[model samples]
Target: MEFMEVIRKRRSIRKFKPEPVPDELIMELLEAARLAPSGTNLQPWRFIIIKSEEKRRELLGHTVNFVVTAPVVIACCVDLNTYKQHKPQRIKELTRAGAFSGVDLNFNDGDKYWKQRGALNANEIREYVSINCAVAVQQLVLRATDLGLGTCWVMMFDQDSVKKILGLGADIDVLALIPVGYADQDPAPRPRLPVRELLIKELK
Candidate 1:
């Protein structure tokens, strides 16, 4: 399918058919997410594919009931440890590859730079992880649309409880829950603000 068509057709599918999503297609969706861009190429995303009825039932308390209707529920998580461990290595790699060409890369002052800090503070880590994880999830959603599958990016959930249910470690945090399958209903296009209202300013 064409890119724009996929974008137009993609919906937050709450209802799904009984047919299961093929394992190969599921992998393709994950592949798209795996290749998403991240800050400093830290690539902190980790996915837990929940398919069993029993496991989905466990997540029901933390998430919406509609999530379990889909054949697959992917628990998207961010590894704080990965971000902490990989920044320096990724920076060095980029420096070697001229990614920061003609730019001064400094680590002399720990106070002034995030790279120099031993680790990001809790809020900083959450914000950074959220942005990167959202990108990956978006890619997964778009790819699912292209494959004639359906998906929903579910964020209205009890994050801490869901994390515990998924058996995530201290270094890992659940970012979003995505339910995927074949759609049972065709939803109308949602309302969008006009372009004029969206544009804040245009500098000459």
Candidate 2:
């Protein structure tokens, strides 16, 4: 499918068919995520493919809607350690490579921003990493749509329960949950803000 067409037709599918999604298709979706652009190419994302019935059930129990019936659930995680200590090195390398030629790459006190978002210390870094992981999730959604698959991004869940269920590493934080399968119903597009209302152009 064309890229624009995929973007236009993609919907948040709530109901899914019972048939299972193939492993190859799942890998294709993951490959799409792998190709996503990350800050400094850190690529801190990790995906946990949940296909086992028991695990799926546990996940469903934690989430309120839109995941139990889907054949595949991909849990997106971010490793805080991926960027914790590499900022200085990354800045130096980018500067040497001319990647920061037109940009202000200096972030002397990066933690200051995170602190404002309620990220206190090292533990909060994991939460900050999860925000990056969400970018990969968006890529997965778009790619899945291109593949003629239905997907729903679910987040209304017990994060701690999900982390325990998935047995993720201490430094890993769950960013988003995606359920993929064939759609049972064609949902109408939800209302969106008009471009004129959303965009602000500053004329100098």
Clashes of each: 0, 0
What residue pairs are clashing in model 1?
A: none
Instruction: Residues 80-134, candidate 2: write the lDDT tens digits.
Output: 7887566556646665776645433334333332344442377556655666678
How does candidate 1 score on lDDT? 0.87
All-Cα superposition RMSD per candidate = 2.6, 4.0
For each candidate in turn, the TM-score is 0.92, 0.85
Predicted structure with the largest TM-score when compared to the true one: 1
For candidate 1, the TM-score is 0.92
